[model samples]
Target: MDMQMARIGLFFDGQAELQRWSHQENIFERFIIEVLEHARVPYQMIDDISKFNTVDLLIVGLASENHLIKEALLEYAASGGIVISYGGLELLSQELGCKILPPLEAGYLVLPAEFGQEDPLRYLKANPWQYIDSESVKQTGELSGDDQKSAALLQIPVGKGYVDRWAINIPETIVGLQQGTSPVTEDGIPAPDGTANLDEGILKADDGFELDWEKDRKTTETGMPYFFTPYADLWREVLLGHLTRRALDKGLTLPVLEYWPAGVQHMAMISFDSDMNINEAAEATLQVLKQEDVQTTWCIIAPGFSKEIYEKAKVDGHELALHYNALEAEDGVWSEEAFLEQLEWLKGAADETNFTSNKNHYTRFEGWGELFQWCEKNGIQADQTRGPSKKGNVGFLFGTCQPYFPISLADEQNRFYDVMEIGFLTQDMNHPSLADTTIIQPFLEKAKRVDGVAHFLFHQHHIYHLPKVKEALIEVVRKARAAGFTFWTSKQINDWERARRTLTVSANGRLEVLGAAELPDVKVWIPLADADAEERGLTYKYGLPGKTQVLQVQLNKVEL
Candidate 1:
């Protein structure tokens, strides 16, 4: 079976129950579906377990009280099929060779499963899980618990197959996050003063900012969507590990770590928001870029800045993109008409006809989906504004450091917004709370450890006004270079990500390119572990305008 189209079934209780449970929005199902879709794993909801034989894997919700469904699942597992159960493990505990124990009073928290280095869920930790008791099963891996003694997740081997029992309520966590409430918060009340230590400094979000608790909460209590923010790569790893294991069990090969370019580990993109002191700041920032031989994206507010400075930055190999001024908008709400008016005015003032990148001032927007749609409709190809604006606080607003097309929360399946979103890791203005300039190094290291993009933003005014800010920016660039990060402007990163989304890999080491005919020439990198085609002298440089390109390799000899 093609992993890209791997057939998986999601068994739910019913449409009405799902709607009522998810608050009539399908948020829970959508969250799971989004994860599956991102992994290129095709899935569909099934009302009957009789169709289990047709799928490679079965993910069933625990809320189903039907005995027929329970019996069907047992039969499927016994017949050598993989089953992952969420919520309702009591119905299958006996079949799984375990006894259900009394639930914990304080519930459970998600932690790394003790499966050593081979565990797929090893990297993901600290999410909330529902409490449950279970007798230890043979060959089981403990994945979650409140303390080291409890078990929230258990992998039970039955016959030729296995069942992953997720006792925690993942859907509830997702639903609570979508509602802008933390699942683990005590009665939904935030800490006194709404300030909490994140990384090294106290992040203050209590001053009536929307999503304030989200920024203040340092741990998984921030809830899903955002809770998954720093761990999107880990989520992908868990999903890919499951799929890869199933494929290997069937004597097949699968590509690994193909999302990043050439598997260089982590990447960094430097950008400067042109706030004030346009001429002096731009000149100073340009000097630093030239000295470091680094190219970056410059977001310019075009009302009063000199066209000569913009042209000079463009000539110096820096990207000049639009910075939508939120203060200019009426009541900080951006309509398509008002947005376009400012975009055109800015473009004309800067003497640029086309712009492919943008970052909104103050990171303000009416709706994330709306902003993405407007950018797509207006010809902006990429954006980097979907993060918190305050300093001393750094976390994923979208739960990913990888570039992805923003999904519409209102219309879950609408895919028309083709613009790419490159997440912001940190900004220079927010670094003062740390002990020294070196605190930013860990942020970059975390991104690298997960093979993510560590895009950093600095205001030109800050660079000119604060000596320590300039020193910090310089240190960041130097450290990123030493860490083997290939620095790219926002436009370059966006273009590369667009090309990557079109790539397809097979278990047998066949590489194919699709839907990239209109894109520019791009250098595709397959990691050495998956570099069987390159070992056989396959072409790595691809010039597009072709719908498909195929390369074959020997998968059996490829090492993990």
Candidate 2:
């Protein structure tokens, strides 16, 4: 907190046409007020332009026709003050100068958007018109209807100050206030109505927009608004940063985590199969991901994937995997007959490189090394080839859903290779009964409690046909982020190893890791190389996995 916090004057001419665009909850005003508070940027609502002299930030809420207020805001900008105007700010942006040219149209944020003019009630929550590349919008990640768009230019630097114009009001500040986050998110629910399906949009030409509420899935419950207060820790830290920057001496000591030597304490891996559409999946799949988004490594890819498909995807910042389904031949790559045959086939399939890591199709046999003894030796860092999961939940005992390597040598019983095993947390997500929101929540809770990483195994076919699942996966990442899950790609891991410190501490010393590696003290529970599972099989018959690690850390823990 600064003694000289920002004195933001929010100009609200009672007749501003912006008022006519009142959000479901008067979100614009709520957002304006909240940003000032959360950012610890103190502000006031002004009804008259005369209230300008003492303010550091002037927010003018203009009616599309409020020419007087618009000009005044320009004057404020020229006078070297922050001038942010919404609602009719388009005219000012073009005549006054800004970056985001007004959009040709706009629409309200809806939960499950309406689709099919024929069957109006087909509640699909997205529109086909949102230009994937909207030059003006700044915030990234997921976009929803509530996030207003401006038909006007979104830019800064009016005269001496900066100007921001919006066609629709975005109450991110208010939503953050209620949800305790500056970003739009519904953390826990995988598909909990307005939460999981979060988005925000703005007003545009109006001609290109269409929203038939009677057919749409709907917005949040009137009382339980889609947006709520965000967390306080972020605001506190930011407030302190600004206060310190202003040279405002407040003796405000804030807790901070600095210079993370080993980042990403946790990570996730996705499994692919022969069905991956390398050529066409980029735009539909990889491109749809949030920008600078969380990264993931693909496993079990065919050798054919590397040449053109993988290269193209790599260009778009996507990772590749061996996608080894050598098990397609019932005998698996281990048997002398299977291994020799599979190895020869794979080696000649393509020249880029052998599969980095291979997975048993259906997990019938995950020992991919049979085909190529150089799993870790080659470059394969992780293996996600476990359960697509049968009726009950499943996982490697002693192994957490989070990434961890088998620290022991592979033996006859449980001879898992030397890479990290990302056990299954959820699968068949597109399957009917599995899509229930109720089911996903408890699963997530159990994951948090039992070191589950919300392991999701998505196939391209699943994403192509079931867009909702694609949406769910997004929610999964969001929830994972909220629950302190740090995303890590092998590259990030390499980054850590590259900068790692050679500890000179005593042999018994240890350190904790968080995010990618939990901190305070990082203690990874390495599974025993082998667990004599013949004498220790799961109760009943591969019974339901409880809050316990399903497989012992040892190789023998996995009953062959």
Candidate 3:
């Protein structure tokens, strides 16, 4: 028998229960459903008020409150059922002792001038409205929520159940509220006395209400989607990158699982594009990488090496990935077959088995998709040879500066991969010949366009040629950090996505691949922060443990 876990009972408040919910009119409700689905908590909809008596989880739409449901809800909570209410349901939060993200709206927000008579709010005295927020809605603008500083709580075991409050502003608002983008506060009011921060000095108005600077100085409010996108510090604070914290709050269920931090557990992959380069010349740079305790997936050409060279690279902690020449393809060989050979050759030296991770070999574009498949076949965990940033026309496949799905290879059912892309934002910023920070801004800007890992790409050879590139790269990292994005390794990112899933052989006997490949016995040596994919060893075999068949392999230096 499979383990029976938490199954929540849902109860609608009086109002929503009676209306016979015509369909999720609010996309916000649909999004909320997605988050709950992502969380993998078992729940069922309860429309018939008569069957609500044993509801394990009660969801009361704000407008759908009723006397009978309210009484049942009180009894359910007192009897120990979980009650989750939202929107107008916030009354439950106050009554049950909690709060939701405040109902806040920015003065800078561009609301529509036209309202339809058929809209939900049009049907009632209290009007209902909807708006879509940018992925970075929190940054660049002010958090113009109502001054409701009320805290939302999840009270466990009151009577036979519990209660949790939610403030819905479409699904992304929750993300926005959490990401420091625009949030929907309770009461939808801005601070009457002006935006107050006890620390930073904010400009004020005479009557004490915050002045609408965005309104007065607005010439082009249309370009920036989020209301705050124009504010410099706010933009930096919210838009620069990843949602490391707010994402965690919607919650990570295993209360005590140790965080295997990408900051410490990830290895940044660095490779130089051109080189009839020498190992000795590369020594100083490699030494610094080692001295700094960083590991590298050092992309090298086969032309310039002797035994001592490989020994030296090994000594300095370098894992070699092949950077081949396109013109030197074997006569009559299809590019795919040629790339396969190259992967084999690289594997011989570096031995990354069954991991689909590779970069370009001489910036070749032919059959790159095949190359990706080839890498996948050979155990390359991920393939990163999207294109040469400075040189090729990175055919808009994977995506801009974010770890995403190969446009053609996206897992359609997995919405996350529906047009995904990620970048190891590698480029020599300090080169006098390089366009400098102005151009750099776009790449960083590219990262803020969506939510995916920004794995920066930089060359150790450039650092060897000019130390300033390293400094400039560090500055880029700082700016990205200030923008709230987390620097991560390819593997670390893979792990983060992997960790977010829960594999359940559902009541219907379905195997769910939560977020990634469900590789249980697969031993992958995850590179440490200071160490990356320098050469590692691998071994594979089959076995039976606890009456289950499994394949086992060990990655020499990587640890999950």
Residue 148, candidate 2: Cα error in Å is 68
Q: Largest lDDT belongs to which candidate?
A: 1
lDDT of 2 by residue, 1-560 (tens): 11122455777666543344343123233334433432223346778776676677666654345577667677777887666554335546455534443333233321111110111111112221222334534321222343444222233555656555433333332222222221211221122332222121211111111122132222222221111111122222222232222221121111112212223434443444444545454345565453427565554334344455555555655455555444434333434455334434555544345444444454443222332234465555555554423322222211234333332111212133355544454454544534333344444554444333556666655555677767766766676677666655544443333222211111112211113222232222111112345634322101111011111112222121
**What is the number of backbone collisions in each predicted candidate, taken in the order shown?**
8, 69, 79
TM-score list, all predictions:
0.70, 0.37, 0.40
Model 1 alpha-carbon miss at residue 3, Å? 13
Per-residue lDDT of 539 in model 3:
19
In the range 525-555, model 1's lDDT, one tens digit per residue, is 3322133432454422111011222233222
RMSD (Å) per prediction: 8.5, 25.6, 17.3
lDDT of each: 0.56, 0.38, 0.37
Which consecutive 10 residues in model 2 have the weakest lDDT in total?
Answer: 114-123
Clashing pairs in 1: 62-88, 101-133, 130-168, 229-399, 253-507, 391-430, 392-430, 517-545
